[model samples]
Target: MARILAEISRTFGEYLLLPNLTDERCTPGNIDLSAPLVRHRVGELAPIRVATPLVSAIMGAVSSVELAIALAQAGGISFIHQNQPISEQAGMVAAVKRHKAGFRHNDVNIKPSATLDEADTLFKRTGSDVIVVTDDGNPSGTFLGLITTQDFNFIRHRRDEVVDSRMRTARELVTGAEGMSLAEANSLLWDSRQDVLPVVSADGRVTALVHRRDEALHHKFSNETVDAAKRFRVGAGVNTHDYLERIPALVEAGADVLCLDSSDGYSVWQQNVLAFVRKEYGDAVRIGAGNVVDGRGFRFLADAGADFVKVGIGGGSICITRDQKGIGRGQASALAEVVAERDAYAEETGMYVPLCSDGGIIHDSHMAIALAFGADFLMLGRYFARFDESPTNKVKLAGQVVKEYWGEGSSRARNVARYGQGKDLAFEEGVDGYVPYAGSLYDNVTVTLAKLRSTMISCGAISLRQFHDTARLVQVSQQTFVQNSEEVQRNERPTVA
Candidate 1:
């Protein structure tokens, strides 16, 4: 007789979320969705925190700077994709970091000698209401004066008037030193009752501008994700083939986190890449790595200094790794197993590495399910792909607006340009597809989060940790599963035609 072993695994579809006993004291609005979803170590230092547990996957051209900025403002993070050139990718990261704040380092500037027509052109190009008048028209140029929408309104005569003729010269402007803190700069603006404050270096070069309106906007969002510089936080992805060249540019471009992106994370190539990065970058930056589906793989990356472990292998809507290569795991099982391992590892060595569930979430309820299974956060591709902010163009499909979506392994995704032909592939692990157009990414996220909060309230859990601790899973009959799915969708706002 031969010995036999039993095996079992679970997927999100195989079970139904069991609600906890309702707490009459709890209400939907009372549920606290705020928590550090990602607590990953940066370099050789303590862990840094990302505000929310929701993340947008780096889906080639679909993950643009606009999407990243939107996600950041909504209390989540987006990984700027690596399919493009390093400069372009870095520029995307740069744009997100520059999107908003009290002090905008990249505000539009104009040379005093430039004509009003030139000023009009610059205003249109940058979409700025105010332009700083500088000696060289650079952010670091010597401060000359300031021009505002009010200044432009005064231009009733020739549109060709020079900026210097109408700009309020330095003598008439309130200025602060470049090294002043945001609070100090803000106070100067308040005391002087000015809407803008020009920050100048010791030699009188304009280094940055502080806007009262920006400060007001910053304080309006109590949960905005920001870096140490108080700029909005963002992440970017890198491949092993270009980590050296790409990492530096991303870091210089103000990337708050970098993930080692790959279809597989257990190979020697990824290990070597980790070693090289640890040696070169030390602990100066936080690094996230994975796409691993087992505890062994998680432990391997953990020992090699992975701060954030991306869980799930073939669960993405576009991924076909399991069907094509016969290598993958059920996302629920993978998340639970790895999270248990993380707890064990934390017990053994006093380090708790956060795990990100990289796929298999189809509905807002699935997000709650993932969190119940101990996923520190959830990462999505198709969900975010359907949004207007995604880089793909909207087209009419059967009389309905739709957007193109695909996986990294898909030829269309790797082509580097829309409508361009892709090269021959050794193997195909993903398919090119499209998603029904969702209006604003922000509005969609808002609705999704609303459902999540409502679900938490119904489950008697107030926070993510509480949900993890109290929530349970219950398997349901195939009929019941169908009914539950339909119920959720029926309650959901219409998404597709």
Candidate 2:
């Protein structure tokens, strides 16, 4: 006799689950949310470690350097979109990597002979508070002197004055050597009693700059995510087809993690690409592969040496894969099955692959639901797209402010020159759409995290690990669901006079 598997599937909205167990010993304030949401090696051979589980999905053009910086500061990682020319995408990655650090290697440099008008233009353009005055206006040029905002403020009315006249010469500024450590640099700045310390080479070329206040600010952020260079850790997406050309450029540009972006991960193209990356960069780069739904798919990727696996196929808000192709699985069911497989795979192979739930999150509470179902972290496009930092601008739609959002498989996304395949798309797996504008990313993440913490408290689980082990789902009647929705609406609606 042959065994038959059940044909049942579940999704996030189909039922409600509550934890039956509670430990009075645990409190919400004491809950440690700092566990490694995702653990993978940076390069081919490094030891595994944790990163914030909340990841930003690769939304082309809409994935901005500012958004990446904001997420890294909040202890999460953002994937810079790869739909443009290699250089443009790489530039965005480099910008995020260089944004904030103990030392900024790419700090702005100005020519000593340049005028305040020129410096003002540079300041307005680059947002740098200090500019190093060099012989040739490059970091490798001979160091001449430096100019700070105070220099400009003093000469505010002298709009036509040359930089050399107002700038403080190098002799007056505290200087450090090129190879000095951050601690030594800090000590030098403190001992010299200077706000800015420039590090220069033996031949007098500028190497890097250290700010006493920036160093102080860095120490205050206990949850910041950074790479070996102490730059905010960031990831980028590359399709299986062009990864051969895209991967090298991205890695060189300081991408901390690389995701294999495909609508389907079980195809030969994905496997070939994954194998090629592992072969070429073995253990040198961390790679994640996905869009899988079941145990077999997860097992295949795991065996193929993927550092992490993404779960979800057609569960995205704009995706039509399930409707058009009828070849996708419900996110809830898919995540459950895959999570079990991940646990089993770890037991069998002793290598744990972190799972990322890729899409279909709408409400803040859904984030908690996904984690309870065993997602190590949630990858969001729609949620992140609503923030002011998204690359798209807001427009008024029906009296409400909204931002443009589109899926990678939509015509708007696929018709780009770099990603254009020459042949017309047979059918779109995604659609272009809009989402209501949300405020700053900081406020949004803070509110969501607060709600998540509240959910954890209600579940009596102090950490995601505990929730994964102890949480259970319970089916509720349609009436109960309707009542809850009505209650929320009533609370949100304004009362009539």
Winning candidate number (lDDT): 2
lDDT of 2 by residue, 357-473 (tens): 998687887888898889988899999899877888678999999989998888888833222345676678789989899977777887787787777877888877788888887
How many residue pairs of model 2 clash at the backbone?
Answer: 7
Per residue, candidate 1 scores C-alpha lDDT tens digits across 1-497 of 96443546678777667777788757865676664544433223334555556888977746777677667767778899887899999998997887544666645888999988888877755546789888899877878898876776534847878888888999998899867888999999999888888888899887777888756645533466777666778888887776778888999999988888876787666777678778988877778888798889999998887778899888999988898888788898889889888878877777778888998888787888898888878889999989877888778989899988889877676622211123456667778878899887767877888888877887889887788778888866788867755744346677797
What TM-score does structure 1 among the candidates reach?
A: 0.75
Clash counts per candidate, in order, are 2, 7
Off by over 4 Å in 2: 1-5, 20-25, 34-51, 99-221, 415-422, 487-497
Per-candidate RMSD, Å: 6.4, 5.4
Residue 471 in candidate 2 has what lDDT?
Answer: 82
Cα deviation at 257, candidate 1, in Å, is 1.3
Q: How accurate locally, in lDDT, is each candidate?
A: 0.78, 0.78
